[model samples]
Every structure is written in C-alpha cells, then in structure tokens.
Target: MTTPLPQKSFHDVRQALLARQEIALVDVREEDPFAQAHPLFAANFSAGRIEIEAWNRIPRRDTAIVVLDNGEGLAEPAARTLQNLGYTDVALLAGGLQGWIDAGGEIFKDVNVPSKAFGELVESQRHTPSLSAEEVKALIDQKADVVVLDARRFDEYQTMSIPTGISVPGAELVLRAQALAPNPQTRIIVNCAGRTRSIIGTQSLVNAGIPNPVSALRNGTIGWKLAGQVLDHGAERQGRALTEKTSADAARQARAVADRAGVQRAQPADLAAFQAEAGRTTYRFDVRTAEEFSAGHLPGFLNTPGGQLVQETDVSAPVRGARIVLADTDGDGGVRANMTASWLAQMGWDVWVLDGSPAADWSETGQPAAAVPPPEGHTEWISPAQLSTWLQGDTAAETVVLDMTTSVNYVKRHIPGAWYISRTDLADALAKVPKAQRYVLTCGSSLLARYAVADVARLTGAEVFVLKGGTAAWITEKLPLEHGETHLASPRTDRYRRPYEGTDSPREAMQGYLDWEFGLVDQLGRDGTHGFRVI
Candidate 1:
C-alpha cells in the first residue's frame, strides 16, 4: 500500500515563490500540452521520460517537488516515480492545474515562460534600445553605413534573415563586433528569431561600451516580415575569427559587466564547495561554441553556447534558484563565461564564472552522464534487419511503426510508412492507427522508444518492439524515407512552430506571435508569481 502523499495548496506554492524558496513545480505532460497552459514557473518534465530527466534536473533527493497535470492523471504516477528514484519530498499540487487557476493564478502559453517573461521585464526595466523593422529596411535599401547582425544561431540565420544581415551569434557580438564593423561610425543592429536574444544581444554590446551605435532590430525577423520587408534566404555571411586584442578587450568589458551585476567568481576550490552543498542543485556549463567545446572542454560541463544560454535560461537551468557555474577556456580568460554569467545574474540567478585555468580537467570530448537504467520490465527489441524482413513479409500489414519524434523532424523525414505520434498520446492515438497485431516503436535515436515500449504493450495488448538504433540506423543502411506530412496519427501540436524558426511561416502566425509577445508584460503583471528582478 502507498502512503497518502502530501498536497500543496496554490496559496502555499505562491508563498514559496514569494519567499524565493527552493521548489520545483513540475508539469508532467507532453511539452505541447504543458506549453498550452501552465503556471509561470512550472518546469516541464514530460510524463513519458520522467525517469530519464528527473535525476539531473532535481539533483537533491529531498528538494520540495510539486507535480501537476490538467486532469490528465499523470501527476500521481509521476510523484510515485519520483519516490522510486529516492526523492524524499515529492507531492502533488492539490487539484492539479485547475486548482492553481481557481486560486487566481495566471496561465501562460509557451515553453520557457519564465525566461520569456523575464525578457519582457528586462525590456520594461532597461528600455533596451531598438530600431523599427521599417527603419532597418530603409537603411538597407539606401545601402547606408550599417551592419546588421543576426544574434541567433548560424542555422537560424540561414533560414530567413534581414537583407544582407550577417550571422554573429550571441556573445560573439562582443568578441567580433569590432572586426565586423571596423569604422566606429557604422551603426550596428542585432537581431534574433524573436525578442529575447535580440534584447539581450543588443544590450550586451551597449553594456560592453562598444564605440559603434548599437540597437536590436525591433521584434526581430517577425517585425521585419510584418513590415512588408523582404528577407534574404540562404544568406552566408559569417563573423570572422576574433583577433587577440579583440578578445582581450571583450574580456575586460565582460568582466566589468559581470562585476557590476554582482556575479561571483569561483576557483576550483569554490567549485568543490558548491558541489558539496546539501540539498542544493548546481549546473556546470561551458559557454562556448559547439565546435570549441567539442574540441576540448572541462570534464563535467555541458556545452550551451553563451548566446543561447542567455536566450533560453529556463531550458538551461530549469531548477529555478540552482547555482550555475559557467566555464570557458577560449585562451582569453573567462570572457565567455563572464559575459554569459552577467546576464544570468541580472536575470536573478545565483550564477558564477569559474576562474583560473581549467587545463588540468580538460577532455577532448565530453558526454552527458548516463541516465538511470530503465527499471526491470518486460521489453522486446527488434534488429533493423529483422524489421526490414517484416516490412517485406506477408504479415507486414499487421505491423505498425510509430515514430515518436519532434513534429519538425517528422516533417523533414521519417520511415516511409511510419505514423507520427506524441509519446504521451500513445494510448489514445493507438486506436486511430489501422488495427495491427504488432507495433514497433522508433525515434531519431531509440532512447525514447525504449521508454515507451512497456506502456504501449500494456495499453494495446500487442507485441511491442523497439526498432534497434531507431530510424537513423535504418537510413545508415540505405533504407527509403518519406518526407512531408503524410501519415500523422495525431495533431502536430507536439512542437510549437515559432514564426521565426523556419523559412515559410504564415504571415498571420508571425503577427500572432508578435501580438502574443506584446501582451506578455501585462500577463506577467497579472501572474505576479514571476520573481524576475532585472539588474
């Protein structure tokens, strides 16, 4: 028999937030559903993969955890899973999501609401300088002395960008802006897919005391599209490598900003002390480019480029109030770490930059710690060769392949006949599939599929098998793939399509996205639970 779990009232949760207490308000639903409606600080730990993601996200076994769902019946089971994983203070939100709503809590739509709301708050407090899309487009038409820089990732720049805009991702704005705009008179405009990165990036240059006039492109590409301005597709301009003097200058400015923001500096001994803190969660990240991190990084640090770290703080440090130690060894001291930590500090995080050299602990490559092994269970696995034979066999009609991948990846490519479905919706969607005697689960890699096998077997009462190595392995062996939206077993709400993410977003969606962002400040005002304090 199970013990009756404790319950947290919405008012109790609000008090915890007010006190800045260490608490994890977990939403145990699919990312899509979680994005549709959730409290301001809720961290999504999707129901299906709770076992894989819980340990790293909530490191302390005794941390206060309140799991919730919108009548989806996932919270109780998720709470039990947390208990099984040695979590001591796990409980369910009384009345789940609905209770929070009844208690006058505001519901926010979208993943990373905390980070996004903070961005709006930053703009409100700092009034970060920006240029209207029409003004930027006019400057481009006149071939004025301006350099437009895309602060998002390089791939994002490649999709759709302002005419002649060059890719100079996040922290690189400080490191490479001088080289890009040699003339001090050149006007600099920084942009991202949307508001967060643009605000943070443009403010970074201004905060760094760059001689060039700096401003973010208002509303980013979305604003440009709404202004009836044409965007350049397949733009290839990239920021050149930073020189030694540039690196040193950037380091000096970054350190000054970080110091102003009261970011702490931690040496190896300090880091050891942080790791020993009882009931405290600490995340170690290397804020450098993926290439640099891949070439060499500290033993235990995960790589999240400095720019993305600032733009997606909620994703990077989901355990709100966790201590974050950023490490960088770009041969220019801790410039990258300092710059990234400065924003995180301003965003109300307990962030620090690792000091001195990390040379001794450097590794040529690093992989994340392995996930806890799946519990003992009845699971079956099928090799790619066997799957191929089955696909060609007389019983092929009785077997169904469900590819549980992001909607974007599903549209890009998948097995020729596989149906796309959210792992969380497996039970409901199974009924929609053509009746089958056998089911094979697959994803980009087989990690998620492995987790889904047992539940699928019990739900459908069919022989369930995981496709070994998943779809990637099949493609490696010259198998055929079908692209486009052909076989969708469920609605494509598993992933939210950002207006600025891809090339061909509908214009109305772009306008809706901007409208949604414009209202965030008002929403944050109503929520009042976001303890965002901008420095």
Candidate 2:
C-alpha cells in the first residue's frame, strides 16, 4: 500500500507565497476543469501528462510542490507520480480547492493567471492606450488611416477576427508592425481573442519605440462580441516573414528592449553549463514561427511563438523558479527570442536569449521523431475496411471499439457503438466494459491510438489492434458515422470548454469573462502570493 502523503494547509501555501519563495501550486486536473476555478498562482500539471511534463516544469527535485483538485481524487495520484519521478518534495492541499476557499483564498477563472494578471498590471502601470469596439468600428466605417493587427495565432484569427485585422500573432507584432503600417500618420490597433495579447502586443510596440500611434482593441474580440459588432470568419490576412534588413533592425531593437528589462544573453557554452547544473530545471524553447522552427531549429528546443509564450507562461513553464532559454534564427539574428525574453524577465523569470550562430550548424529538419516503439510481438493494425467487416460479423458484439478522440470531437462523431474512454483511465475503465474477445482503439489520427496499443494489451491481455489512419481515414473511405454522445465510458472532463473557442457560447459568459479579468488585480491583492514585478 502507498504511504500517506504529506499535506499543506492553504494558509501554509499562502505564507510561502507571501515570503516570495518559489512554490509550485499545481492543479492536477485537466485543462478544462482547472480553468473553471483555481488559485491565481496555480499551474495546471494535468494528471495524465505528469510523466511527460513534470521534468521540464518542475526542474528542481526539492522544490516544494502542492497539488490539488476539487475532490476529484486526482491530487493523491499526481503526488505519487511526482514522487516516483524523483521529485523530492511533493504534497497535497489539505482540503483541495475547497480548503483554499474556506481559508479566504481568492479563486480565479481561466488559464494563465500569472501572465494574464501581469498583463493587467502592465496596463494599470503603463496605462496602455485602447479604443472601444464602437470607436474601432467607426474608424473602419469612415476609412480612416488605420491598420488593425490581430495579435493572436493565425488559426485563432482565421476562426473569428476584427474586420480588416491582419494576423500578426504575438512576437511578430514588433517585427512586422512598421512594414504593415509604414506611414507614421497611420494609426495601429492590436487585438487578440481576449485582453492579454492585445494589451501586451500594443505595449510591445510602444516599448520598442514604434513610430505609429498604438492602441489595444479594448477587451479584444470578446469586447467586439459584447458590443454586438460582427466579426470576420475564415479571414487569412497573415503578416509575411521579416526581410533581411528588417530582421537585423528588429534584432537590434529587441536586444535593446531586453537589456532595459534586464534579460541576460546566453552563449552555447553558458546553456551547456545551465543544463549541467545539479539541481535546476531548465527549459529551452525556440520562439519563432512554427514553419521557421520546422525548417531548422536547435536540438532539444521546443517551438513556442514569442507572444503566445508570454500569454501562456504558466502553461509553458509551470515551475516558478525554473530557468528558461529562448532562441530564434531569423536572418542570422535571434530577434524573436530577445523580444520574448524581455516580457518574461519583467514577469520575474530568470530568462535568457540564445545566440543565433549555432542554429545554422543543425542540418536536421522537421519535427523530432518519437523514441518509443511498439512492444515486441504486439504489432497489429486493423484497417477501417476490416473493422467494418468485423462489425457486421457473427462476433460483432464481442469486438469492442474505443474512441480516444477529445471529448468534444467524440460527442460530434464516432462509430455507431464505440465507447468513449479517457486514455489515462483506460485500465480502470476496462472493468466497466463488457468482456470482449478483442479491443480496437482509434482517435482523430492513428498516431495516438498506435501508442496506446501496448497499454491496452498490458491492461487486458486481449487481442488489441489499432485502427489504421484513425477516424479521418475512415471518413475518406466513406464509412458511416453516428453523431452526438451515444456512448461514454467516462465523464467528459478531459477537455476544457473555452468560451472563445465555440461559435454558440452565450454573450453572458463572454461578458462574465471580461468581468473576471477586470477583477484579477483585486483578487491578487487579497491573495498576496503572486510574486509578479512589472518592469
């Protein structure tokens, strides 16, 4: 039997925060439930993802970590997982989320509370200029000399965006703004799905000393919707990659801003030394466009767009005291890295920008290949055609099919009698499934399903098979599909339902989201645990 784990009262955690010490208040729930309500400093280290993300997120083995969930029975298991992974200090919140509330701790809605709160702090301190939805709409209606820049990922901009807004993303804002609005007289407005990126993007240009007048589209796309303004759907106006001269200029400017923000520069040797440190967690990321990163990137470096990194710091790096290294190879200069490092520095991170010279030496291109292979003597793939034949056979009732796609996607479409199960809970969920001679697994793509073949086999000792090419391939072959949630072996808590993601979210939820953000400062004041320092 597992030993009883240590526990921390909310007050103890609060005191630790007040002391300005490093503490990772982790919520072990999935992104969806964690986003609904959590402490301001809580980092979501989802239960199913602990093994993959724990090392990078919590670098120091001895750093204090407190895990919690709303009585979902996930915190204990998460704590045990950390202990097994060589984490020296791990504990659970005494009463989970409710304990914090009973202790008068503030609860925040949404993800990336640290970054979002810091953005609010930046706005309050710098008074970042902004225009309401009505004002911006009028400017477009009158054909004013203005350019609206969507400071969000291209896919988000494609989903729904302000009319005439160009997809500039986050870190790309400073690099491409001058070219997009060459005339100094032309006013520039930056926007995102919500307030953080819009505020940060606008402030970034102002901090870099751009020539044009910059303002955030107040409250972002959420504000636009609340104002009853129509948004453009499937818009594809994206900023082009920076030119040679433009990249050099951007590098110089970004380096200067980083210096002002007290961000350090890391050489290849310095990075090696950082990794060699005995008890520190270090994350190395290439803060460039996905395409640029895919074309070529440093070994051991993950790609995270600069703007999104700042917007989702908690999600990207959960350990508050861990070191972070940012890199970019744009025209022989790490411009995006420097710019991204500046914001992270201001937000109280020990961040560094890497030199761009070494990036050219790596000849390898495309995503890094996975290291794990299928277990020996367990290689079997069932084509959609074969699966269809089985479904119509005499033993059809004995062949069990499990769909591992997202809860939302599973609800939208699945095989007629396929049972929806969480990949993390597959072993336990098998007890609920009727005994079958064989089990078949499938997802949106077969990649994840293939990875699960060994696990399913180990848990049940049955004939397990992977659906070739997944559900997408089945549709290509004109296979019939059933819609809606017909069968579910588990609760639909694996994915978070974002108000900004779907088209049919209520206006009240959108306004409530804005209202929650507006109150973050006050909540931070009450918590007194957020160790944020705006530069």
Prediction 1 TM-score vs. true: 0.95
Which candidate gets the maximum TM-score versus the true structure?
A: 1
Please give, for residues 260-346, the per-residue lDDT of candidate 1 as tens digits.
Answer: 988998888988888888978888988888888888888767889998888776666766767889998848757778888888887
- Candidate RMSDs in order: 2.0, 3.2
Clashes of each: 0, 2
Which regions of candidate 2 deviate over 4 angstroms?
11-23, 51-64, 85-88, 241-246, 330-332, 369-386, 423-435, 445-483
After superposing candidate 1, which stretches have Cα over 4 Å from the reference? 364-366
Q: What shift in Å separates residue 233 of candidate 2 from its native position after superposition? A: 0.7
TM-score of every prediction relative to native: 0.95, 0.90
